[model samples]
Target: MTDPVLRLEALRHGYPTPQGRLPVLDGVDLSLSGGETMALTGESGAGKSTLLHLAAGLDTAESGVIEVCGADMAGRDDAGRAALRRAHIGVVFQQFNLVPSLRVGDNIAFQARLAGREDPGWTAELADRLGLSPLLSRWPEELSGGQQQRAAVGRALAARPALLLADEPTGNLDEASADAVMELMLELTRTAGCALLMATHSAALAARLGRRAQLRGGRLCDETGAAA
Candidate 1:
């Protein structure tokens, strides 16, 4: 059988404060396979974002293991981690980190080009499905919050990465817009058979995913509050 798309085993991380090292993630463990979606829920400061960052290889863990598509992330440098991320992972941040200088179309195609997997057909389809075709030539500043977030989603999935990580992706949108974005994200990821791991505070949104995992006391638990 094939390996899981993302995995974390006995993960631990902490931050140094005036008092000492305060633990964020403590012995966290998770595994996600292809075409699966998992919602990560937690209260504020529960290490949800920290876990996602470590899973994406954007930050290092104090101890334990992180594997993406069966490749271990323990000894990789920044550049190496970046290479792996570009090749196998996609991320959508709450802030919608689009390139201000690039037009919407270019932004949508950015990650795919970086991964050397750009396909005009797929980009065009994404633009059409995301309702951004008309706004492709417009600058990001000209778009509203929802539009900008849609562009960010397109950009992240453009490369068809094996795993997708989203941190509060709909936090900035209104109720209607958030629902629309969520629907599109779920549809696209499902169609592409990518693994989705999203960090969210909304119970409604979390329920939409196939599985739910909550962060508490630096570890993950199931919807019933049992250890995951």
Candidate 2:
């Protein structure tokens, strides 16, 4: 069988406080294969975001293992981690982190360019599929919230990453816009055969994924009954 695209085993992490270290994630385990989607759900301060960040190599775990595309994330240095993220991972957040200075076309192509695998045809196809072809010439600030989020999705998928990590990607949009963006995101992830792990509070959104996992008291509970 092919190896899982992402795997976490006995993962633990915490933050320093005046009292001591405040635990966030404790012994969380998960595995995701290509074209699979899992929703990470929990309440405020439940460590959902922390898990995503650790998985993306944006932050280090205090203990246990985080493997991306069969590579141990803890084994890589800062530069190596950055290289790994650029090569195999894509990230999106509630705040659309588009480069304001660049036009929409350039913004969508940003990550692919950084990865040194920019394909104009693929980028153009993504823009068209995202319904941003008309706005490609415009700046991010000029587009509506939905339009901007669509562009963000396009940007994340521009490089055809092995894994995609999204944190409350539609939190800023209205219900209609959020649904539209979610549909496109789901469709595109399947089309690209990328593994997606999204942290979201909305049950409606979580229900759309292939699997669901809840974060509670620093541990993970698989709602799908596969594992935890």
Candidate 3:
């Protein structure tokens, strides 16, 4: 049997402040299934990004366990974590994080190359899906914000990772562009059977994900679940 795409147990984290320790996540627990898409929404400073960072193993939690695809993140060293990320995890940040020096096609294929899962055909198909086929030779700086973001999504999906963690991926785009990008991302993830967990501030976007959870006062509430 396959394990969950992601799992967190009793997660607690905080940061040292000028006055004292500022708590972020407090004994939080969450999970996402394979091929599932979940939207995480919260107010600024509510620790949504913090939760993603911990889930991605980019930051250490004060305590708790994070399991991605059945492996325990808390047990991995830096190299182990890096290897895990390269193997099964893909991250799309708000900034698009494309390689400015690489051409658009190369940028989209970069992570797949690093993950050693390069599939030229799939990458080309993704480019077509994202409407980036015409701009594949262009540089990141030359593309519009929506195009850059589409390239970022392509890069993350090229690896065909088991899980995709997106941190406000459409936050930089206009409303129309945001809607298009979000739609494409969801479609691609579903086709590729990749689990998606996106952190966003848009309630409308969250509602489209089928499941929406909010981090409120260090607790994760199933907003849609509550409604249902």
Largest lDDT belongs to which candidate?
Answer: 1
Clashes of 1: 0
**Which wins on lDDT, candidate 1 or candidate 3?**
1
Model 3 lDDT tens row, 27-51:
8898788778999988999999899
After superposition, candidate 3 runs with Cα above 4 Å error: 224-228
lDDT of 2 by residue, 169-227 (tens): 88877887678778867876788788999999899999999988989888887775444
How well is each residue in 77-180 modelled by candidate 1, as lDDT tens digits?
88989999999999998888899999999999999999999999999988998789999999999999889998998898889889999999888878987888
Candidates by lDDT, descending order:
1, 2, 3
The deviation in Å at residue 115 for candidate 3 is: 0.9
Error in Å for residue 197 of model 1: 0.2
Clashes of each: 0, 0, 0
TM-score of each: 0.96, 0.92, 0.93
- Itemize residue pairs with steric clashes in candidate 1: none
Using TM-score, rank the candidates from best to worst: 1, 3, 2
Lowest summed lDDT across 10 adjacent residues in model 3 is found at: 219-228
lDDT (C-alpha) at residue 187 in model 3: 82
